[model samples]
Target: MKFIAHINIMPKTELLDPQGKVVVKNLPNLGIQGVSDVRIGKHVTIALEAPSEQEAHDKVELACSKLLANVIMESYDFVIEAQ
Candidate 1:
């Protein structure tokens, strides 16, 4: 089976996101107000060969834990879909 994995990696809420903060601050200047506490994150797409949805999920989780995200400061989520 083929699976498409969509992953999102973000810094923990307890940590400061300088880039997100900058964007949030700039939004008001651009006439976009009432938005606060914005946090930036990364998105990754991966195609994988697996026998089942569970297998694909496991593979993606392992990849995120080992390489895609910094477990100490960041967290990740993924959705697996048939492709």
Candidate 2:
């Protein structure tokens, strides 16, 4: 079976997101008010062959833990779908 995984990596909520803060602060300056709590993150998509959906999910999880995301400062989640 072949699967495609969509992953989102984001800084932990308890951690400070300087880039997000800068955007939030500047939104008002750009004449865009009422925008608050902005956050920036990364999106990743991977295609792989696996025996089962569970296997695909596990592999993607490993990829996220080992390479895609920094567990210390960032968190990640993914969804796998047949392609």
Candidate 3:
């Protein structure tokens, strides 16, 4: 079976996102308003072969924890779908 995983990696909510803050601070300059906050994150897509959905999910979780995301500073989640 072929599976596609869509992953999102984001800074822990307790941590400060400097880049997001910078954007929020400058939004008013562009005549943008009413937005109080912003947070930048990464989206990853992985396609792989697996025998089951559970297997695909585990693989994606491993990839996120081991390489794609910083476990200490970031959090991640993924959805696996047949492809």
Cα lDDT, all candidates: 0.94, 0.96, 0.94
The positional error of residue 64 in candidate 3, measured at the CA in angstroms, is 0.9
lDDT of 1 by residue, 1-83 (tens): 99999999999999999999999989988899899789999999999999899989999999999999998999999899898
Which RMSD values do the candidates have, in order? Answer: 0.8, 1.0, 0.8
For model 2, the local distance difference test gives 0.96
Order the candidate numbers by TM-score, best to worst: 1, 3, 2
Better-scoring candidate (TM-score), 1 or 2: 1
Q: Which consecutive 10 residues in model 2 have the weakest lDDT in total?
A: 27-36
The parts of candidate 1 lying over 4 Å away from their true place are: none
**TM-score per candidate, chains pooled:** 0.95, 0.93, 0.95
Candidate 3: global Cα-lDDT? 0.94
Residue runs of model 3 more than 4 Å from their true location after superposition: none
